[model samples]
Target chain A: MRAYGFRVPGGFHATHTYEAVEAAERIGYPVVMKIVSPDVVHKSDLGGVRLNISTAQGVRDAFDLMMLRINQRLPDARIEGIYVEKMVSKGLEIIIGMSRDPQFGPMLMFGLGGVFVEVMKDVTFYIAPITHDEAMQMLMSTRSYKMLVGARGQQGVDLKAIATGLQRISQLSTDFPQIAELDINPFIVGEFGTDPVAADVRMALQSPED
Target chain B: MLEPLLYPKTIAVVGASKKPGKVGHEILANLIKGGFTGKIIPVNPTADQVLDLPCYKSPVDCGESIDLSLIVVPNRAVVEAVKSSIKAGAGAIVVITAGFKEIGEEGAALEREVAEICVSHGVRLLGPNCLGLINTENRMNASFGGDIPMAGGVSVISQSGALCTAILDTAAGLNLGLAKLFSIGNKADVSEVDLLRVLGRDEQTKVIVGYLEDITSGDDFIKAATEASTIKPVIILKSGTTVAGLKAASSHTGVLAGADTAYGAAFMRSGVIRAENYEDLFDFATAFAIQPLPKGDRVLIITNAGGPGTMAADAVENAGMRVMSLDRNVATALKSKLPAAASVGNPIDVLGDADPDRYLAALEAAQEDDSVDAVIVILTPQAMTRPVETARAIVVGCQKGDKTVLASFMGGRGVLPGRDALAAAGLPQYYSPERAVAALKAMHDYAAWKRRPPRIVARFRVNTRRVERIITRCLRANRRQLG
Candidate 1:
């Protein structure tokens, strides 16, 4: 099953191994290491995530600690190592999700991201394969969107780009039954005019047929 | 129209058994124990005697024509039992069996088959997967399920079996009686709409209450409720109003609709009263069942405490009813009755130290004013404020006046005497200002709706037709595939 994300202009993927850590050190500083285990969808829950690694030893130490933590917490999960991506700076956080309801068919949910998803519970749902109209409605329903629209002198996040991204996620969930859940948290909205980038992504796929 | 089914003169347990713990035997025991005035027949194949009544082999074998049949048997045998009951000319059948639509596709097909059987035979089926109905007024225990209900004015119809029992138990604790109770689980033939339509016309049914997960026939529910609201009040406690709540409801009942905003609009247009919580629903129903509708939306606030009066004012305003400002004459009259230090406003805070006679005097003055449509008297505990005597005085003053009187006693333990005294006098009383204000608002709204014509204009004209066509085609396709 293919997992296609919205196109980020300068985005590139880097596979993390013992050698990749050394390469990352040679290339740059301030990288994020995320556990790439398909079984562990929420890597941060098991402490398999390390952010803002600035040095060679920082990379090596974080890798060791993350590996040990993942093995200790989820002993049965297969370790596919990790993905080291450039540490993107702060932005307006949001979450988009989809699930097939038995009665209402496919449903798309969009809301404020991070811990605020539970705390604020500012979310809206629509039957999936959502039109652009519905996507815009979901964004407008949430109070966090106030900040996205430049509340309190903050630069307004690009709403058109966010709406397009949401539409892609909805289509993806409708297209693949195997894709149970997917999340891209803190997809940093770079500047006033710059497009948002998916900084950290975690996905869960259905087990292969017996 | 079907009085015998509701208040049966003769009820026959088709699958009755001599075994002590069986459903049929338990139902018979409960019916006999509840002192049902109707004649009971036990139909068993082998046993000559069960529950001290002659047990026949079948409904045909039992000589008398039965009004209702309580069918408690396995899934395969239900069809045969229903067929026999139909041949014996039974009017209604309450099927207390599971393994139907609620399970999955195949079970849904079986449920349709049972419904078809009922339709073809002209026998109204209460449920294929239900606890069945109870007419407490007539001591008619038709349900095979456990709860022996008490007689009261509130009639509740629940979509869930467990919730029905829970509401019954809670109502029992609250000293509320149910006029009739129905657990319409998996409503194959008889639906909530059907029951609502029937009970709406029932004379003994003062308050028609419901606990619903979904409205299967949205148009039918709107139509039935619109007509029902013309005569009686319909209070509903619907669960699936939020996305998370919709998820829980689906897992509980497997039915989901669009957003709750649409449902709210539909409910408003149909003139149905929606309650926020379980306690609110029961409290509103109790008040509606007992109290007369308010003459107008103008409300007079009477309180011994200032904070509760403010709270009552807020609640009253929130419910879209006005808190009446005291007339100059009424204020002058109240000033003469109250002490000089007392605040003689609309809420008429007569001071906590005021006696029962002072409360009576204030209420009398407020009630005499033509501008005051209703009066809500609030009492708080104080050293000199005789709670019981003050309640009696207010009740007496209410009896003498033309205005509707409502009371709020705002404390935990100190409010019992006031509540009991009001209840004994058949006057509406609430524990909190919010509840008292809500009840008064509902009374006001009901009176207003009664004056106006029913306002449902049939949205979903094309969508409903399309859905009906789709359902018809699907049913026909499924029948062909099965055959």
Candidate 2:
């Protein structure tokens, strides 16, 4: 799920695994390569992720290294080959999630993305099928949102874009019954006025019976 | 006086037994032992006589009508007991049995049967599965539990029996009072919403506190709470906030929420002060019962030491209150009165070497300042700082000023003398700045909630047809499956 995230601009599960290298070459240089193995949830932790693969040879080498790393890291499971995609530049990272709660049902969570998600629980939630007003309210609830609004001469990220993205996930949850949770971390919210793109999308589907 | 319900004039233990360990014997013993000023009748069918009272075979044989009948029998037998109580002209019934809705599907059916019986007879049912209710106002101990609570101001309503006992035990140690306590278990018929609506109107109850794991009727609970909060503060310590907690609650009592965050947002919107922990729940309840509502969010800090005062200022700000800058004249007065080395700011730090007079002078000046809405006096142990005398001065200052006064005495045993002095004067004291700030914030929040226009959500009466369809679908899908 995490590996599928690096496949930027390509809708999830749209392209074949074997064509990923050719797709990256066709797309552009400075791409990222990650191992798409169900057994390895935290791919980055096990050295299954490699960034800045500028050439076709670089992609192949990184892919080979990732395969060897996964073999050593996860000996018992099957590997689903590798994923290759374009790399995104540094930008403000935000985390967005959808979780089903017993009390409130499905809820949309917004907070500062990346490792900060755990350390700083600076987050807010709005129940699914959220109104635009609720989506805006969720964005403003976090202290990090203040920072995103250009607190220190840093350009303010496009909040409307973030809200729209949140609304999409909320709608997705309502539409796709199998999608239990969707995590978009470090959704590189670009410099002021640019639409924020999902730098990574890790989605968990409910079991077939569920 | 609603004596029959709130302060029963006469009581009878319908299932009173000779067995020392049984609930029936314990209740009879509690009433007699607690000095209940009412006629007591022990009714037991199997025994000719019991508990030294005029033992009767049934409620019918108890001679005169009994005002309250406490039934502590098995689940299946409860329906008969309720019928007998109504037949005997008992005004109210306290049923202490477990095998009701709390047990499972079969028990829920039995609970509905019991409620139907109570409603038909026009008899008020306390619980089909409950620890029972107690009225401390007139010393009426109708609950089947063994413990007797201290009678005072704060009234508690808990959904869990064991939690009720815990609250009573905790209340006793804190020297808090109880006007009434209800353990509305299973809530098969009588619910928290009903009790809240009734208790909200009770004059004796200045503050209403609750420990609920699940809210059966969210709409009704919110309505009663919103109305009640207008008159008295309603403090709730809601459990089942986490995923695991919610699961545990479902197993304990069938409760499901769409999400926890929605509950949180609803709590805030409804003007209910949600306590983060058990201690805060009781602490805030105690503070609300004693302290006057703070007028505004602007607060003043006065301390014998600078560190604690500054810390308090930061905490106050964190609690959504502004630490007001002292008035120029007040700052000048404090500067002149204190040593030259002392900082003459909003937190008029009168150095560790300051005297009680200096502390009093700072507080007096701050109290009179129009900018300062409230005053937080910090007492840190030092070679010259007189904790007891300083506490007395602050208490006196509190009595004189319209502004609220809060104190934080930071040491251990050394702080106790000051704490005891504050307590004697009915002044609220905290062991740390964070606690003091939290208490002050709660006071401010309550005051704000009280002033706002009441937000009453129109009760959405269940659409029986729609609900029936959902239930039928659920039953057809699988009784064991829960989404």
| Per-model TM against the reference | 0.63, 0.71
- Model 1 misplacement above 4 A: A1-210, B17-22, B144-152, B241-258, B453-483
In model 1, state the lDDT of residue B109. Answer: 87
Q: Please give the lDDT score at residue A99 for candidate 2.
A: 63
Interface RMSD of each: 14.9, 12.9
Using DockQ as the measure, which candidate wins?
A: 2
Worst 10 residues of 2 chain B by lDDT: B248-257
DockQ of 2: 0.08
Give the clash total for candidate 2. Answer: 11
Error of 2 at B277 (Å): 3.7
Best by lDDT: 2
| Native contacts retained, all candidates in order | 0.00, 0.06
Candidate 1 chain B weakest ten by summed lDDT: B248-257
